[model samples]
Target: MIYKFCPAVLLLILSFSPGNLFFSETKNVKEIAKVIKTSSETNEEAIYNSLNSNQFALPQLESFKEALKGFYILKEKGLISKNILTLIDFSMSSNSKRLWVIDLTTNTILYNSLVAHGRNTGNEFATSFSNSPQSFKSSLGFYATGEIYSGKHGNSLKLDGLEKGINSNARERAVVIHGAEYVSNSFIQNNKRLGRSLGCPALPLELTDKIIQTIKDKSCLFIYFPSDSYKGASKLIS
Candidate 1:
């Protein structure tokens, strides 16, 4: 008489077959991991595309990509608590609106305003960076937004540098984010460039409070510059 096994039994038998008809546990795990990584990449790509299509200006694609990578890494490490990313593209001229505060959850650009680099960073472009106090040069890398407080700049946001040696001295250097009168279009029009800060990423006076409020409290901030040394040294991005 002919007999048939249930599907479950058949599957069990196939799982032990010499040819390995069914995936081994290791292979299954790897496949699942692959799927998860692919899904994550797809999601990142979607967000990038959405943000790129916005009507307002955006940071350069490469700069945004690096910043996004660091942002997710920081989020994964529990270093960032908010779904906000503030990007200062020091690669662009100070006259340009290179500071972009983006709401990552909504894939929207909340603020795209002019920002000033360090006094020693460069004239029109930020060509120099530092992690030293009194260097008066901006530091490039990832930072975590800290508590808000009123300082000499009125309302300001603190920044805790994430990458050691790259920007870890942010706190000691008093490199906070604040509004400055010289970080405006009018200043640029008159001076041919935005005024430089001591070492802070100063924003337009009108936008300082709002931008700080939106990105403060454990959000990610990335000051991007296409430098080979920084790219290789930054553990968050490298």
Candidate 2:
């Protein structure tokens, strides 16, 4: 009886041992850290650092953060189906390659090309945006890539604006992505700025097919501008 009692006591002591407690606490700590790392803002900063270190021409970190934030939210909501993210930095001058097509899954830059804003937006920089039909001014915010259609622009990709009152009228405005002779380097050298689109985010005629194919079909497209009003009011990114 005394031997059997000793074995039970030993088992109870081991169950309450510091080593057991240490293992349980360590596991809990790891789980907590995993949750924090998964949702922390530092994750965005880390991704930006990774992209920047890769030598790809990336958008400003602030803009990239906002773009990434919105991208995640949109993806969670099932608005964006693809892992590709297209960012058009309207804050940058038209002469620069402000359009960045990124592969989020692979963490690589697919295309860094010149994308033209609406003619009424600005000459060198896009300062104005509108969602009104025929406004011909580019609308700022998030957009979902729509079906590819052979319209007047030829093999154009339609864009479904996601932000209401900011760019929801994109389809009605016919603000699609298409090839444009004016969106090339030659046009920029002659005009001192890239040619403007009616309201479309026009791409170089040469890259139009490739970009349209890659970004089409429910990818995330974010037209970023450092506007206080848009930032404050945007329901998606705000």
Best by lDDT: 2
lDDT of 2 by residue, 70-125 (tens): 99889989998999999999999999999899988888888989999998999998
lDDT of 1 by residue, 1-238 (tens): 2324445444544555544535476675465556555665566666778884367876787888888989977898899999999888988888888888898878888889898899998999888899999899999999999999899989899999999899999999999999899988888889988899998999888888888888889999999999999989988777
Those runs of model 2 whose alpha carbons end farther than 4 Å from true positions after fitting are 1-39, 52-55
Candidate 1 wrong stretches, greater than 4 Å: 1-43, 52-54
The local distance difference test score of model 2 is 0.86
**What is the TM-score of candidate 2?**
0.83
Q: Candidate 1, overall lDDT?
A: 0.85
- Model 2 residue 154 distance off true place after TM-score fit, in angstroms: 0.9
Give the range of the ten consecutive residues with the poorest summed lDDT in model 1.
1-10
What's the CA RMSD of model 1 in angstroms? 8.2
